[model samples]
Target: MLRHEFQPGRLVAGLVFAAAGTVYAGDAAGLWDTPWFVIVPLVVGGLCLAGATATVTRGIRRRSGKKRLGRSTLDG
Candidate 1:
C-alpha cells in the first residue's frame, strides 16, 4: 500500500531538495562559484515546501473522503 500511497509531487520535491543539497555541498569546496548558486537552493526549497503543502492538503482531503468520485456499495 505504501507504493500506492506515495505521491509523485512529493517525490519530485524531495529530489529537488536532494539535488540542492548536493550542489550546495559541492560548491562549499570553493572549486567554483556562480551567481546562481544561492538562487538555486532558494528555488528548490520553495518548490519542496509547495509540493509538501499540496501533498498534505491532498492527504487530508482524501482521508476525509471529501473528493470521492462515486457512491459506496452500501448506497445500493
Candidate 2:
C-alpha cells in the first residue's frame, strides 16, 4: 500500500523552482548571467502551468473514481 498520494503538480513546480534556483546559483558563481527580472515570468508561468495540470489530473481521477464506483455497484 502506498503511504501517500503523489502530487505531480508539486513535482513540476519543484522542478521549475529548482531550475530557477540553478540559474541564480550559476550567476552567483559567475558561470552565467541572469537578469534581475528574469524570475518573475519564470515563476509565474510555472505556477500557472502547474495549477492547470493539477486541475486536469484531479478531474481525471474523479471521473475514474466514479466509473469504479458505478461498476462496483452494478456487480454487487
Q: Give the candidate number with the greatest TM-score.
A: 2
lDDT of each: 0.69, 0.94
Candidate 2 lDDT tens digits, 28-52: 9999989999999999999998998
* Residue 14, candidate 2: C-alpha displacement in angstroms: 0.5
- Candidate 1 lDDT over 1-76, as tens digits, reads 3556646677666767776677677778775664566766676676977687778868886877843533564465
Tell me the TM-score of model 2. 0.94
Off by over 4 Å in 1: 1-4, 34-37, 40-76
Lowest summed lDDT window (length 10), candidate 2: 1-10
What are the models' TM-scores? 0.45, 0.94
Q: Least accurate stretch of 10 residues (summed lDDT) in model 1?
A: 66-75
